[model samples]
Target: MGRAGRKTVLFDEDKPHNRVTQESHGFITQDGVKPSDFKKRARTDVQKYPSVSIKEKRVEIIEKSGGVFRIQTKEGKELYGSM
Candidate 1:
């Protein structure tokens, strides 16, 4: 996503792992990689981008109206933007 181009992007902080460990499938190169390994790699790639920022907080509420969206984060941040 490009900065100041898109209307909104919300990232709900989640571990993304349903269980402690899992097996990979269908990928030819890394067929049976560990779940943690994938997570770490993905996080690293995201961190490499200058436009991507990471946040850790549950989104309490999100509402949209009149081409604008408002999000209330659990970290006590209220944000408004256009779409």
Candidate 2:
């Protein structure tokens, strides 16, 4: 963010709380809001930035030993990550 995002960080939010209702002591403004609602709002806010790409899929394999990691996607998309 200091000088534009140079790399991507694949964040894992697999269990993004399928069912929950309200949080009252953490975030600002949205105090006592539904968890799902808060996630929706958070995702929306994050997605507003062009650099972020949200992928809703299970991470099958994550081998980080070599200089790069070869990630195999469920949809068969092989992504290489610098290690």
Top of the candidates by lDDT: 1
Instruction: Evaluate model 1: give its lDDT.
Output: 0.67
Question: Can you write out model 2's per-residue Cα lDDT over 7-62, one digit (the tens) per residue?
Answer: 44454546754355446447778777877777777777776666666777666776
Q: Candidate 1: where is the Cα deviation over 4 Å? A: 2-14, 25-31
Local accuracy of candidate 1 as per-residue lDDT tens digits, 1-83 = 53544433436477565456586667566668876676677677666666666667677888998897888888889888764
Q: How far is candidate 1 from the true structure (C-alpha RMSD, Å)?
A: 3.6
Best by TM-score: 1
Candidate 2 segments whose C-alpha is farther than 4 A from its true place: 1-4, 7-31
Against the hidden true structure, what lDDT does model 2 obtain?
Answer: 0.64
Q: Per-candidate TM vs. native?
A: 0.62, 0.58
| lDDT values for all models | 0.67, 0.64
Look at candidate 2 and give me any clashing residue pairs: 22-34
